[model samples]
Structure formats: C-alpha cells, structure tokens
Target: MNSKFRALTFILFMAFLRPALSQSVENAWVRRPLPGMKLTGAYMVIKNDTNKDISLLEIQGPDAEYYEIHTHENIDGVMKMRQLKKLKIPAMDKVMLKPKSFHIMLIQIKKGRLTKQAKKTELTLIFDNKVKLTTETKLSKGPL
Candidate 1:
C-alpha cells in the first residue's frame, strides 16, 4: 500500500475504534412507580468496554428535583439506602443495577403532573471523562 493511503487508513480505523473501546451505557431501565407514590427507582447496566476503569459521576433527569446514586446496605439485618458519591465500573466488566442494590434514586418528583401510567423518560448519565449518555427508560407503576 502507498504510504499516504496507509496513513489515512490508520486514522480512519482509530476514529471508529475509539468509541468501541471507551466506556458505554446499555440496557438502562426504570421501575414503575407505585400508585399514589412519588418515589421510584431506576436501573441500568454500565459497561466499561475499554481497558481502563471509568467512574460514573452523576445521574440527572427531568422528572425529579434531585437524582442520587445510591446503594442498599445491610446493617444489622436492616437494609438501608445510602448515597454514593461515585460508582466505579471496572475495565471490561459490567455492573448491574437492580432492586435492593446499587440504583439511581429519583427524589422530589414535580407535583401536579400525572405519572400513574407507563411513559418513556430520558435520563442523562454523566461520567468522569465528561461523556454524557442519554438513555430512555419506560416508567410504569410499581408493585402495590
């Protein structure tokens, strides 16, 4: 191959490969809210496809006043939720957020808006590398 052609090919390959090797978010979903309750939970899968670990800085959305990254801790047989400053996803590993585990807590829902039925909501996840991932989740009524 010509030198110039080879150089151009390398550049193009890097451009496409960068995103695949970097951190990414996948399979993000939120639990349905309970009837007559303003509080709900969100879950997602964070995958660090790169060779380096990534830290999730924050989570935000329009439905709640404040979104917190939290984890359920079992203290003396009592499970309690606690705020987590940051969530770490190891390199080439996947972290699953589920009920009674690490989750995103949506607090202080805006009043006067109906949220009893299932609807699609958008959430912005901020990472330490300044990458923002916008994911859609279906909001439904939680178990009664």
Candidate 2:
C-alpha cells in the first residue's frame, strides 16, 4: 500500500479506538449490606470524554457470584427492578447509576469479602468494542 493510504488507515483506526479509550468510571461505590444479607447495590458515573458514543455490554467481578445491570421503573404504581441487557453512555456525556434508578446488582456475594481492612471491590466493565475497564469501588453506607 502507498504511504498516503497507510496514513489514512492509521488515522481511521485511531479514531475508532478513541471513544473506548476516553471512557472512564468515576465515583464508584457499593452500599454496605445489612447483616446476613448477601445482596447489595453499586453505583457509579460513567464519563465519556470522546466525541463518539459508547455502550456497556456487561459487568464482572470477584466480589459476587452474579452481577447484573439493573434499573428501577414504576410499573402500575409499583416500583420494581428491571435487568438491562446493555447501558449506553452518550458521546461527551455521563451516565450515572444511582439508587432507585440504574445500578449494579451484586448477588451472592463472596463469603467474607467485605472485611474491615478490605473495604473495596474490583469490578471489570466490558464495553461494546471489547474494551474492559477494571475499577476499584469503595464501600459506602449510602450515595455520596
């Protein structure tokens, strides 16, 4: 291939990777569960610093046996949690996962995972472009 064509291809590839590279997870925290409770919720703000949109595919972590993206909606005057297949983060914007809204459901937490000294959990968020972001979230009593 010619040098001009090679340069154009490189530029296009970089552009494709820009949005995935610019995305970041901020202010992530998992609420402390009540005694004898094995389930809890986590919240965070996903910031998109790029000029293009991005989507979150799924989440995985060692703290819990199961993790799901969930949101609460009012159904017939009753609010209930609903699982989401994917969450979208708009271009140059932020998506916040908070209580009574979009958040992460952590089920069947690992035994003794939340110790006094270890007050944080590591979560890996997978995106549409196969980009994985590993973030450490501190434990909290409520939204900060």
RMSD of each: 3.7, 5.3
lDDT of 1: 0.81
lDDT of 1 by residue, 5-91 (tens): 999999999898776676666767777666566777888888888888889998888887888999998889999989999999998
Best by lDDT: 2
- Model 1 misplacement above 4 A: 1-19, 112-114, 141-144
TM-score, cand. 1: 0.78
Clashing pairs in 2: none
- Report lDDT per candidate: 0.81, 0.88
Off by over 4 Å in 2: 1-21, 75-77, 115-117
lDDT of 1 at 99: 82
Question: In model 1, what is the error at residue 79, expressed in angstroms?
Answer: 0.7
TM-score, cand. 2 vs. native: 0.79
- What's the residue-level lDDT of 103 in candidate 2? 96
